[model samples]
Target: MVRHMDERAGVDPRRTDELWLRESERYASTHPRCLQLRERARAHMPHGVPMSWMASYFAHPPVWIDEGHGAHFTCADGIRFLDTNVGDKSTFCGIDPEPVVRAVQRRVAAGSQFMLPTRDALVVAEELARRWKLPSWQFTLSASQANTEAIRLARHATGRRKVLTFTGNYGGHGDEMLTAFAGEGRLSYLGLTPAADRDIDVIGFNDVGALERVLAAGDHACVFTEPALTNEGVVLPEPGFHDALRELTRASGTILLLDETHTLICAPGGLAEKWRLEPDAVVVGKAVGGGLPLGAYGMTAELCEAFERGESLTGRPGELATGGTLFANALSMAAARAALTEVLTPDAYKHASALGAELADRLEAVVAEAGLPWKVQRLGPRSGISFGGRLARNAAEADADEQPELNALLRLCLANRGVWEAISTAGPALSVAATRADVAAYVAAFREFVTDVTGTG
Candidate 1:
């Protein structure tokens, strides 16, 4: 059973709330420029920001980014921060990587889009196929689209309409994946209109028995999930979990589709390659375009053949509704090509892996010394800090470890102290451009926050 937030995690909720209020006031007073901009921009943009999530990023006004380079960025108020956010794991190779920038610059001059295939696109597809060991590839503007298309392909191939996804696993913003299981197995949606009411089902993460039972019904077209649930704070797969999953899926003739959008930071070829877990279809986004918007999905030879048969039977060449006009724009292809070839090389992964281990060790030590229950879980160069001693096995336990007010307090503290953790729910991502100084800054801020809030120094 998952422990409640008030249980085990040694946090004084009242004190933390008080500190959050005090910090919010301090942030508002100090960043007057940001405050003024937020007030003025509210007339134009929703909640004074373009994205809805920006409104909930802070108790006070969100800090507008002035500019970013390498492992750090400056806010609108001229306060520079050591960025552990790394564009919410999108800029995993670091910002403005020279090769990607140069490639995009050249491609932009030649042509942005032409509704025709480019040499760079072919090269990128080949590289992705080489990395993931898949035979065919398709591109989309975002991971959500990639996931949506992958689902469509799975259903078309299997003649099954239902998709089984683990609870708390996020695969973009597709309507089919937007549904979540409320407590007691009740289903709910993030929006008013349900994206998938009858076609999508929720299962337990790492529960091979549950997976086997569901797939045994022979009703699900695909099992869509991340190798590990990163969205809910890094719920790892249990031992022998993948072995059972593969056996069950194969036996039941269900396609296993792994979403590696955020997990791309986990390894050079992402977690699928690192762990030697083979899936019929794979989806990747975020860092694929070297900080630009691009997502790709790779299909095994069998799935590719199935897709081709579906396309032929449909009687339309490009009207499958799987892609948009600018799905594979030349600029995005060029950037992805440079990113896969020049930036995210083996050397880069080696360096980031070492750095991530060190960051996890240091953060864990700090928490231990403070006598806190928090545990730091690292996935390659990225890590998440959970308010529990043991790592979560599923989304329910992962959600139980979350303390929203405490999360806000820590994020505000890190921001105020010159450290930026972009995805506040997860952990920090150490980019290739990140230096020792950046790591030190992050450690220092975490130490200060832990000691201050827990009074353990």
Candidate 2:
């Protein structure tokens, strides 16, 4: 039986395919410059992009962006697009935020990096501690690195060899956190050995029973999770889920590590602060540096003390568990200082959250007017339309709710009409620089797409 039968029946797949064909033709005709660039790029780079994933992630050919200002960007074709994706939330503060730009400029002129720490590192760490309520902090080049280091620290502090994660959770690209549960066994991704799976366990989100069962083993180092499942389309935790998770992990002597990298969109302090979560450690990245490459992990003072007493992997005494040559570089620290103090302020979050709510409401109304069995799921300044009428409770249901053909058609339609939505797996999000006008533009394009797909016009 099809789980999303109502959604499937509302819009005929045959009509969707036909409209997709039309949009594909329109995209090809209108984006000649992007096409030419792709051809030229293919001669030097694989799949016409520096990153292989970028080559086929979009419904239409990837548009070459010339520049971005506040809430919009111009493509190589001289067309401006309302940037709802915001670099997949990497530029959540908005493109070229003045304070960050000025800070970066000064840092570059002075010096970009040194193995030594700078005053900005102290300032950034202080700000992060203040916001997250964690005393000790460390930096890395990306959230993936932060997560990796956090896992190692957890292992060191607890003398455990295993890790725990929830289903549909993305805790960076690290090998240890990348596997998911398959039946009674684990499913490791390519390039990962079965050895990595031996120490990892995956369970469904919001399943307190499963979490308790796994943590009871008493050999797990940490339970890594987001405040909510953002990458799998904003699957929020049920009421009291976090409370149970914390209680269970605490009782079992397992560390609770929350990755707030994407969930930073939830608020200035991310969901940890917004929800008053008391995680032992928190990981953050992406927009925290105003789009510069910066990631940080903060630990409670107790955990910090434990980590200090712990030995390094090489059996060195009194050495910290993690450090990188370029970690805490001057440039990243400068940008983070500016971003936290000036760009991602309370007022900016207020504006972005308002715009996010407005976009979700408008899209929901559009679906209702079109009489489609779809709904918009929102998290803070982020929102995405799920094809199913009800929200998904777990990863399996979320995966089942996916309508690839419909998603691709919607993305291509929005792209052709000058709104750049997020990639297929993610959703549109408002940046701090977004305005009502941008939200309206996105709604207009989305409404048109609905009309075309459902023949509701």
Candidate 3:
């Protein structure tokens, strides 16, 4: 017998897989153009896309997009969608915001890049310092680069060989930050030498006692983390968690490195401002560039001084992990300056926060009314829906509560009705351009899906 969608506990694995396959087949059948493109492109690319993860994101081939603008994009097959995923928060200000577009256009006409430096770079750096309350800043081409460089800086300043990171929290694709705590104190790593793996210490998020105990060893150089957990699920920090994190790291002389790529949705100044977190170093990317690729790492006064003083942990000069040739390129600097000063302003955040709350509240109401075992949560302009009723306290709980089959079914349902969300997490990020109607449309589609799946309409 088929089970109700809301029946999650002790769910039949085979049934879930079957349901996902059904939806996947349906998606492929409807989009013949997508299928044709997929076959044709496979001759050159491994999975008919530039990236392999794109193919793995959906059970079916990824949808091809023709054009995108504020809050929406048209698929290659001509289907338009309310894009809540917002390029995984890479376009949180909205696709092609006029300010960013004009900045790029104007700068490109003047010049795109110059290894020496550009005036826009200084302006962007100053703006970031003002927003984040940090004194020194450096630019990179991506968040991964920023994070990797931050770790190197932390090690150089502290003269330590090991790094501490929470399980299920992703810092970036850097080899050192690519490890996860696989529950029960077991750690797993990817594409790193055993020596590099050992330098990474994995622990559970929100476990203050565990964090303190680990740092007490005095071998860790830094604790890299997102202010609030995301991707695996939106597990928020428990009360007093940030305070404890700050206290432990400071006492142990471990640099606190925060990756705000996703948690930038927490507020105008990101989670650091919202929660009043004072990390030694901070990394930001994604929407910071307003669609252009850019990343930045900011440092406190002491950390900056340490780097300049050549205070390497091992008595060796620190390598230049800070930037690349195109890091502070003219075009990216102009785009970032425009995004920070004009597009992602206080007014835009106000709109985004309200819409985020509206989407979360409406979805939660639907679940509550239907008496389903589901919950919705919002962090400023970001929101997520999870399977269990109560919020997850940590990554382990969040992982256990995930409903992949439900996620696939809902994704397909929403896509069919003109909504698009992040496939990895099914999280929605409200853009500055998102309207009340967009939120309403998504909520209505979700309500319809819940009623249909649960047979409670």
- Where is the poorest 10-residue window by lDDT in model 3? 1-10
- Candidate 1 segments exceeding 4 Å error: 1-7, 57-60, 181-192, 310-319
lDDT of prediction 2: 0.86
Ordered from best to worst lDDT, the candidate numbers read 2, 1, 3
Clashing pairs in 1: 85-422
lDDT (tens digit, per residue) of candidate 3 on 1-457: 2334445633344655664666667777667887788889999999898887678776556788889999999888888899988887889989889999999999999999888789888998898888789989989889989988888888888888788998877777766666543433434544565455668878888999999899998889999899988777687899999999999998998999999998886677799998899988899998889889899999999888876775475667645456689998999999999999899889888899999898899988988888776778778887878876668887777776766667767777777778887766648788998999988999898887776566555
RMSD values, in order shown: 2.9, 2.6, 2.6
Minimum summed lDDT over a 10-residue window in model 1 is located at 180-189
The lDDT of each candidate is: 0.83, 0.86, 0.81
The candidate 2 region of ten consecutive residues with least summed lDDT is 1-10
Residues 1-457 of candidate 1 have per-residue lDDT tens digits of 1212475678877667767777777787778898889899999998999887677655446788899899888888998988887877889888889999999999999998998889999999999999899989999999999999999888877778798889888886666566643423433545635445477778889888888788889988899889988877778898899888888988998999999998878788888989999999999999989998899999999888877773533353432448889999998999999999999998998888788888888998999898888888988887768876679898878776667667777888888898877665577889888876777789999999998788665
| Residue-pair clash count for candidate 3 | 1
CA-RMSD of model 1: 2.9
The C-alpha stretches of model 2 lying farther than 4 A from their native spots are: 1-9, 181-188, 310-321
Roughly what TM-score does model 3 have, to 2 decimal places? 0.94
Per-residue error at 450 for model 2, in Å? Answer: 0.2
Model 3 per-residue lDDT at 56: 73
